[model samples]
Target: MVQILLSLSIFFTSAAQAAEKAGMPQLDPTTWFPQVFWLLITFGFLYLIVEKIVFPRLSDSIEQRNDHVSDNIDEANSIKDQAEKKYQEYLSLISNSKKEAQDLINANKQSLQSNFDNKKKEIDKKLEEKMKEVSKEIDDFKKSAAGKIGSISTEVAKELVKTVSKIDTNNASASSIVEEVSKKYLKGLN
Candidate 1:
C-alpha cells in the first residue's frame, strides 16, 4: 500500500510539472480525454465501494439501532401500563380500608351509646328503690310516735294545773280535763 501511494504521488507530480511546461494543460483539449477517463475511474471505484460495502453496513447498523430503540420504547410503555394498573389497585384498597375503618368506628360508637343507655336505666332503677325504702321508714316512724305524743301532752297539762292552783286535784277529773285540753291543742295545730 505504501509503494502504491508513493508511485501515485510521483506520477501526479510529473503530470503537474509537464502540464506547467505545456502552458496550463488542464485547459488544453488534448489532455481532457485522459483527465475525464481518470475521473470516471475514481468515481466508479468510490461508487462501487459505497454501494457494496459502506452503504449496506451503515444502513444495517442504522436499522439495528432503530429496532433496539423501538423495543425499549415498547418495554417502557408496558411497564407504564402495569404501574398504572397497580396504582389503581392500591387506590381501591385504600378506599376499601377507609370504608371498613369508618364502619368499625360507627359500630363502636353505637355500642358505647347502647351501653351508656343501659347503665343509665340501671342507675335510675336503683335510685327509685332507695327513695321508696326511705319513704316507708318515715311512715313507720310517724306511726310509732303517735301514742308517745299524746302521753307527753297529758303529763305537761297536769304539771301546769298543779303550778297554777297550788292545790291537789282529783286524778280522774284532772285526767278528763287534760284530755279535753289536748284535743283543743291538736285541733288548733291542724
Candidate 2:
C-alpha cells in the first residue's frame, strides 16, 4: 500500500513536469525511469495473477478432460471385446446347430431308406406269390377246359356227321377224328 502511494505520487510529479516541458512523457528522458518502474510493476502484477489464479485452473481442467476421455475409451474397448466374444459364441452355437441338424437329417434318411427297402422286399415277395398262384390257377383251368373240349368235340362230331352225311357217328370214331384234327391244327399254329 505504501509502495502504491509512493509510485502514484512520483507519477503525478512526472506528469506535471512533462506538462511544463510541453512534450510526450514517454519521450522525456527524465520521466523514463518512473515510466519504466510502473511498467515493471504492472507486468509483475499481471504475471502473478496469471500464475496464481489462471494457470492452475487451466491445467486442472485439461487433466480432468483427459481423464474423462481415457475412461470413456477404456469402457468402449471393454464393450468391443465383449461384443466380439459374444459374436464368437453365436458362431459356435450356429455351427453346432447346423451339425446337429445335418446329423439328424442323415439319421432320418437312413431310417427311411431302411424302411423303404424292407417294404419293397415285402411287396416283391407278395407279387411273386401272387404270380405263382395265378399261374397254378391258369394251369388248372386249362386242364379242365381241355377235358370238356374233348367231350364237346365228340358230341359235335356226331351231330355234324348226322347233318352233313345223313349218318350218325360213334363216340370212339368221333374222338379219334377230333384228336387227329387238333394235332394238325396245333402243328400248323406252331
Candidate number with greatest TM-score: 2
Candidate 2: 10-residue stretch with minimal lDDT: 19-28
> Stretches of candidate 2 above 4 Å error?
1-22, 45-49, 162-168, 188-190
lDDT of 1 by residue, 79-154 (tens): 9999999999999999999999999999999999999999999999999999899988887886566456666656
Candidate 1's C-alpha lDDT? 0.86
RMSD of each: 9.2, 10.6
> Compared with the true structure, what per-residue lDDT tens digits does model 2 show for residues 1-190?
9999999999999989978887655677998888889999999999999999999999999999999999999999999999999999999999999999999999999999999999999999999999999999998997787677877988898999989998877889999988888768767966
lDDT per model vs. reference:
0.86, 0.91
Off by over 4 Å in 1: 1-22, 143-147, 166-190
Which residue pairs collide, candidate 1? none
